[model samples]
Target: MLTTRLPTKVEPYRLASSGKCLEGVIPLADMPRVVEAIGVQESDVRISLTFDIDSQRRSFIEGSISFEASLLCQRCLRPTEPEPLSSDFRLGLVTSDALAAQLPGEYEPVVVENEQLDLLSVIEDEVLLVLPQVVYHEEADCAVSRDQLASGVEPEASDAPAVNPFSVLRTLKDKH
Candidate 1:
């Protein structure tokens, strides 16, 4: 468990140089952005990070985040837990895109704004990346019956055929 309230921010460069490792749980309630995105859920997300100076002498951070999120199923209009969301990432601290571009593809570029790396923002971004864009249960598993979904009862095709005004134009062309 992390300290009472997880750290809201950290200085990545300094931490990496010092080679500090942090493993903790961030209560769902402590993450406003995550809460705002996923709405309220039952459990806390686990956060683990290790900071070190890479071979290239750059400060880098690597970590994994895991948590369960419940999203409303579009088909049933009920909440469903799709899967336990978890992901691992590597970040290279950089202040500019030029520096970011130099980093290997394996590491994501984390821009340091005034030397501070926002911990919450990073975690929220990782979680959102793994979340489904459109949440829905499998058709077979949906609580809403298939018939209910397909019940798109389009008004019975109107009994009368529509008259095309082009018919009059064709008649006028023929008369001409």
Candidate 2:
């Protein structure tokens, strides 16, 4: 629902102090790392972020991002239909590793330099985290059939009893 374009860069500390909320869209093509990982994307990524200082006086950014993208189907080795991906995250803004380590477990630490943060990069990283490790279409829709997946032939059942490789080891132990 957010149609406004989000700013590419901002000072998280300043925004957190003012308790600002930003909602907007970022063109998917603008994120190089995401594009490289998932291939070309035509849809825009919708994002919402709220910056505030917690009771502990730690500056943090809470945000959610949603987008649609086509991922390569592992079974078919082709692009599957566009799938929706989204993630919600809480990140504590920190200037150093020690400060980051001090943050509570619930908040992931995001190190900022010169008080500046790249909003797009942060959003893109979240998108990557939410991407499926393996993608596949529904069985009915997949180009590769179940039989074809088994190399187009049903496995034959052998008449002989199954042999256990461990039987030799068992015999050796018995002799010992």
Candidate 3:
């Protein structure tokens, strides 16, 4: 396991040729983009990646990343830990959308810029894509309930009588 900052840019051709593997922990603070999206960053992200060339001779990398993150449950407005965040991906490099579209569905398209890949951004994108679209705590765990009503000891009478619109319509119909 390599315990160091991964190269900011990687030459896919040379890396895939060697079929190298790297394992390391990316500090949570280093992933500022992910922290902004998730709203909380605490644990270091464990990353393991392997470089390879697929059968079609396309340079690609496969890897898994996992971490523990805290998220606020929208319903409860309190913190909750999501299931351990982990994901596996195989990103195939392409310089153009047309080439990316031609790739097999199993391989995610990664458009390379200037023939280099930004490894940190790739990891952050993967994590962001897998996040839950909506957050909710278990019903029993929630502090707020839909049935709860405001404290009311008595009902105050209104100065004016309430009128039903439907009754007025009914009177008009009867008169006609």
lDDT top scorer: 2
Candidate 1 lDDT score at position 105: 89
Candidate 2 per-residue lDDT, tens place, 78-126, comes to 8888888889999999999999999999999999999899988888888
Candidate 3 versus the native: TM-score? 0.77
Tens-place lDDT per residue, model 1, 22-117, is 887777666677778778877777889898998879888899988888888988888886468888999888999899999988899989989898
Global Cα lDDT for candidate 3: 0.80
Candidate 1 or 2, higher TM-score?
2
What is the C-alpha local distance difference test score of candidate 1? 0.82
Model 2's TM-score against the true structure: 0.83
Top candidate (TM-score) = 2
Clashing pairs in 3: none
Between prediction 2 and prediction 3, the one with superior lDDT is 2
- Assess each prediction's global lDDT (C-alpha) against the native: 0.82, 0.90, 0.80
TM-scores, all models, native as reference: 0.77, 0.83, 0.77
Q: Which stretches of candidate 2 lie over 4 Å from their true place?
A: 1-3, 151-176
Model 1 residue 74 CA deviation (Å) reads: 1.7
Which 10 successive residues of model 3 have the least lDDT summed? 145-154
| lDDT digits (tens) for residues 1-176 of candidate 3 | 37556665677667788998877777666777777877657677788889899888898889998887777888777878656878999988888999999999889999988878888888888778767777877778878775553465668898998887699789888998
